[model samples]
Target: MGKKFFVAGTDTEIGKTTIACGLLEKANQLRLRTLALKPVAAGAERTAEGARNDDALALMQSASIELSYEQVNPVLFAPPIAPHIAAQQAGKRLTVSQLAGYCRGTLMTPSDFALVEGAGGWRVPLSGRETLAGLAVELQLPVILVIGMKLGCLNHALLTAEAIRRDGLPLVGWVANRVDPDMSCFDENVETLKQFLPAPCLGVVPHLPGASPAALAEHLDISPLGY
Candidate 1:
């Protein structure tokens, strides 16, 4: 069986997709087949193909094993809002079982790697009673956290790591994405995380003018991830 990983983030807009695609690029470098799944997505735009998400599109480009947009992002919400709120506005119901089942089937595909990304954060709501984290637990996939390095990153990263551990999910590794290029003492903050978080720092990505998966791939070191 191939390896499956859950790409989670400390908070929204924290370079989760950037890190996920970089991992896909690394798998491609090893000539391994990869499938990237964004099971549920919000903030979609109408396109020639239909409503699509930029993050899902980027992931599709990075994936080695091609699949339709629908296959990659099964549930899409038009409003640029929280998933549960969007679902409620659209009169659609989401459940942990549904997403878990989709992930299970995707894992059965013949691929060297499968990376699934969550919408916002680990505990974002999929429904009134169920959270996206519940689906990750159901899938039992080890997590790769994307930490957006900035002023409050130390607290955010540590808290996110603690929550993942409390949920009994293995924090396989983490990526340090420099969102704020001007943030002072950047290297020191990274060193502090290394001292605290148990997982290895897979990579420390710096700010780029126009970053693509292939471009960011050069900055990432996936050796510690064992993929």
Candidate 2:
């Protein structure tokens, strides 16, 4: 059995894939086989083979184990919109049970570390009555939150943490990604999050343009993840 975690972000565009890739890279450094999955994605480009998502492609490249694009991203929509809306446009429905089954089947492959990256924020709608959070609950995976360090991040991070707790899942750790290059009171805000969030800080990633997973891995500590 391998250690698997559900990666969630405080909000969309919060560097969840970047942080998840960094963690996978760091685990690979320790000679651990790694796998990554993006159960649902809203944005994709039409490829000759099929639709491909950039985030899922990046995760596939970062992992030590190779998986087909479809295995990595089981549900994909062409437009960069809310997943539920995109699914509706495609005349498809999204359900937590279906996504969970996809994730569980892929997770059967052996690996030292594996991650299931959520599409957006914790409460992103999958359908009229379903949200992505339900998928995490269905899998019963511990969570690793990615906090986009920026203006108003404190409220977002706190509220997200509260929601995770309310969902009855363990928030094992969090990463602070510096998404805002010029956000005010950055260090102060990180300190406040460390004080309040119900998990240890895995890393604080400074904004670096075009940084590889190997480069970002240098700043992350995976021992907190029990590596």
Candidate 3:
């Protein structure tokens, strides 16, 4: 068994899936067996058999371990809304324990590493009072904060790190994802983060279309994130 990490973003649309895949790709390149778990994914597309999220699909692509879709994405909702609301519409109850059980069963087996990706932001509701932060706390895995480089991102990143710290989870490192091409002072923002954030900037992903994980890994300079 190896270190399991919870990959969280400052906000939705902040490239959590991209960063998770990049980690898997990089670890696999080192010839380590890896698996990815999405835990809970809302806004799924319906297929002939069932529904799936693109993030889930990408995780499946990156995972060296073959897991059933249910193992990778346990709680899935058809609509793209808050997990609580989506679950309500479908008459399903969402809870951290349900997700935790799935992860336990799936990841209990030995492997080089496991990366569990959370949906939405850290404080997004999983159920009534169970936020993603609570789940991360329960799992007790080191966290990889994915900072989407954009206007107002500094506040988002700091606030999220504070929340994670308050939750008492380990802040392993972070990735600077350039989601905004026109984000002014991007390098300056990175410099500030390097100074303030206790964790290293694992990577700074430049804005590019069709950027492979191999290319992303080249720019990544963070010390190996975990044991």
Candidate 4:
């Protein structure tokens, strides 16, 4: 058994993986056994062994210990679109119950934490009737939100925070990832999130040239989980 977190982002490409990397770095620094999971992936490219997705691979790379890629990303789609639609287009089926079942096993293993990064925005559908929110509740884990700092970030962060609250989930903390360098009022936007969110501000991820997990983790904050 281990402490776990559900990582959701304000939007896709909002540095959710970057925040997960930050937490993974901290777990490794503490010498704690840890793993990161992206239960569903929408985009993928060819690898020697069929196909693979970058988001899921990035999280596994950040972990100190190695885990089978399937253990991390249980549901994968080839298209870069909403997972439900992608599943249909790819002639596959995805359900929240299936994801929950896999994650339950992953969470049951011995470790300090398992960070599960959700697909797209917090509300993306995994199936026609179920949402990512339902999966979060099924897992019964606290949430760590990744807010992409850019124009209109305030609205995204606040609305997502509200949804977390509505689901009766504890917002463990949040990370601010600087996605758009030119977005105005970066500091102000961060401050706004810090004030409005029902959780602590874990850390601020500043944008760096040439995307890599190591650099992002350096700035990402992994505070103590109140488990």
Candidate 5:
């Protein structure tokens, strides 16, 4: 049983994959085998391998070990929409037990670090009743929240933290990703989050003109994560 962390974003497109890949880059430096899983994804494009998700692909590329796309993302929907809606459109049901079981199996693989990225926000529904948060609790993995720094981010970040605590999940750390380039007082916003969030802010990723996990890893400190 190796170490694992559940990565959840304040909202979708909040750079969760970016932070996860950065962590993987750091883990690689230590020569630790890494595995990343995007349990459910909505947007996908057809390729020779089948429906492909950019986020999952990035994780696969960053991982120290190679895993087929299915292992990286077990549940994928072609349409770019809310995961629950996409599942409904495809006549597929998303359940907490099934997703949690998949993650447990993946963690059992021979790897030093494993990251399981959730589909959407913490409370996003999988089926009509089960939420992603519920799956996190079932797995009992420590969580890392990705905060997309933008207008109203304070509310979103704080609320998500409170919910994670309420569900009894340890918030191991957080990443502050600059999603909005023009957002004013970025430092002040980050300070406010640092002052309020229960866990330490592991990294503050700026809008990268180019995407390089190794470059982004320079800004992150995962030492507190005990990995």
Candidate 6:
């Protein structure tokens, strides 16, 4: 079995996919086979193949082990909205068990590294009672948090880390992605996170526009992830 991690973010548009792909690229640099899965994604466009999401596509491109689009992202919603709402709009039900089943095959594939990226944040809803966190819990995978560095990141990162621990999952590592270029005291904020979050700091990615996973990979250190 590969080293698999459930990647979560502080919030939406917080570079979760960016950090995940970067990690995959880093693994590839070390000649390590890699796989990535985005089991549930909202916001997709119709494609020749089927409903496709940009984030999932990026992950597919980054992984050394190839998988079909459906394999990488089994659940896709057309509207760019919360997944639970999108499921309701399409008359479909989103459940943690169903999503976990979608991911099991790829997770079991032979590889040195694998990642299962979640939609939105850790507490994203799948149904009235089930949150996306339950899927990670079901898999019993350790977590890698992506913090979008900016104002209020301290609170967001701490609360997210707390929730992951509260769910009885280990927070293996975290990445600090500089989403806010102009945020004051950025170094101090990162220092605060290192002080508070109960995990090793994997990387600190500066804000780079239109950067590819290969470029972002230079900013990350996958050593702490046991690569």
Cα lDDT for residue 40, candidate 2: 94
For each candidate, the alpha-carbon lDDT, in order, equals: 0.90, 0.94, 0.86, 0.83, 0.89, 0.93
lDDT order, best first, reads 2, 6, 1, 5, 3, 4
TM-score quality measure for candidate 3:
0.96
Candidate 3 wrong stretches, greater than 4 Å: none
What is the lDDT, from 0 to 100, of the residue 186 in candidate 1?
Answer: 97
> How many angstroms is residue 151 displaced in model 5 relative to the true structure, after the best TM-score fit?
0.8
RMSD of each: 1.0, 0.7, 1.4, 1.6, 1.1, 0.7
Clashes per candidate, residues 3 or more apart or on different chains: 0, 0, 0, 0, 0, 0
1-227: candidate 2 lDDT, tens digit per residue: 88999999999998999999999999999999999999999888888988899999999999999998889999989899999999999999899999999998999999999999998899999999999999999999999999999998899999999999999999999999999999988899999999999899999999976899999998899898888
| CA deviation > 4 Å runs, candidate 6 | none
Query: What TM-score would candidate 5 get against the native?
Result: 0.97
- lDDT top scorer: 2
Give candidate 4 regions above 4 Å deviation: none
| Every model's TM-score | 0.97, 0.98, 0.96, 0.94, 0.97, 0.98
For candidate 6, the per-residue lDDT at 83 reads 91
Report lDDT (Cα) of residue 24, candidate 5: 93
Global lDDT of model 6: 0.93
Error of 2 at 144 (Å): 0.1
Predicted structure 1, TM vs. truth? 0.97
lDDT of 5 by residue, 10-127 (tens): 9987888988999899889888899999989889998987889999999999999898788889899999888788899999898889888877777788998889998778999887
Given candidate 2, what's the lDDT at residue 165?
Answer: 94
